[model samples]
Target: MTEPESEGMVAQESLRHTYLQAIGVQSWLPRGALPHAAPSAPWVETFTWPPTQRFEQWEDAFEDTSEVPAAEQPVLPVTPSVNAPRGVSRALESLQGMFAPEGTPSQKVLESTPPALSETTPSASALDMSYQPEPVAPLQNPLAERYPEPQFSLVLMTLGELLIVDSLPPQGRQSFSPAHIRFVSALARSLGVQGYDINPIHHHWPAFVGSALNQGPDEALRSVRRLLGNMLKSQEIKRVLLLGEASAQWILEQPEPLDSLRGLRFSLRAGVAAVSSHSVTALLRIPELKAELWADLQPLLATRT
Candidate 1:
């Protein structure tokens, strides 16, 4: 995309996330399977338990009664100096030290400060004490560890190649049409990782191919080079699964004299393996991949007829 278009998307994303944060909603709402809007009249549903069945104790009643004022929260006078294990006493002493004001205490002042003690069993008052809810543990990064950051990080990997058989002259290809994605899904399924194929097809190959189409050869080549460099440098990826022979050739950029990717001068990075596979038709004929993944990935790559 153009700089302006990219910037606009970033700005929109920022606004959406910021709004969600302000409203104290879960970030997953945007990423999750749940609907984004309120339920319709027919879909809306609600029910409540009887109060006795709902609450088991007085504290529960107190919590349920929002009518109680925060200022009216009575501070219970807890008895002190009950005998406790040395560990418990020491822990309480440490806690008191942390919460209490600074400086050595005079004997008189120490005497006034309640002894460090907790009942062998917690007192009703201690059990009833409530704390204000802390802010949600800083929202965990949604994408961390799930996807490679868009930076260039190289890794040793098993790489596969895919080549798309182009359509007839009447129908020229542009971006990743159905064939490319189907091949990717097919490859992934050839392994046993059982998630929808929609993911990598959107993020991985497109990162390279999309660059080429929008900005022309040099720019596209640069993106692919960087992606490869990063993949090796960062160790972010492991296996390299090439989808179709045509896609494999496109990346290899054989301008002419290449009928099939089988003859392409592709090099596997040291320590990384590359598995070049036949298309869906070739594999669909067989019930199983040489292994399960070939079978699995092939189906994921296949487009619904």
Candidate 2:
């Protein structure tokens, strides 16, 4: 290397060593000086036994007490005067009144002063025993009276791993109409499921014969969830088809309109996929809903195929 390049490299190394030493790192150097590097300073030990300079004894340091004067008393802050701001003066007066004796002028003024009354407040003479408040209505049972007696019927049918939840007709009917039967059979066939493979399980709300037991929505929901949980445990159910609003409400605990919930998939408690659609009865009554139901069923059909 040329002379200037060699000098520049040595300077860079020296700068790096300086940085390392500054950060408390002990940098190693050649025992003999380098060709271009500056001579390093000789090392010296800073500490020595029996410290070189003498420290004065504790007794000797405290012995010269004659020159030190006694500590003066601390001064207290002066109290604010009456000429101060109204808020400051009032605060001071209140503090003074709090500590003042019973016979003081402040105490006397407080004793003579009358409490301020509101303009709307009635006089003592006007409030008589004859004036009576209206009797408060008895609190009704919020749970039982708040929600009407839940009356709904649903049929839970399983075909292979698919669970179909549909609302049954009113009047305690356990089975679906012929039209519903045909529709379900066709749907099953489309999904590559045989008619014989389909098993119907009836679920009726407010199962109790009498009104003695609590049969509110909460209780009904618990009952339905319990039944669904039991079914999920018993069968290898993977997907759920919720038909009608009642089936959706009780099974999914979702009371939204079927139109809003129809095409969307939901995750059930046991990781089962669920989809809600119009009831078979509704499809029969209003044929136009079939097209919407068909659109909704397309995703499930695609999965099945």
lDDT of 1 by residue, 144-231 (tens): 2322222211111222322222211112223444554565455445453335434221123324434444443343345555655655
Query: Candidate 2 — which pairs collide?
Result: none
Q: Candidate 2 regions off by >4 Å? A: 1-148, 172-174, 269-271
Summarize candidate 2's per-residue lDDT along 30-64 as a digit string, tens digits: 55667888765332122111212211221121132
Q: What is the lDDT of residue 110 in candidate 2?
A: 75
In terms of TM-score, how similar is model 1 to the real structure?
Answer: 0.27
Cα distance off (Å), candidate 1, residue 52: 94
Candidate 1: regions farther than 4 A off: 1-186, 192-198, 201-216, 232-236, 253-259, 263-266, 275-305
Cα TM-score per model? 0.27, 0.49
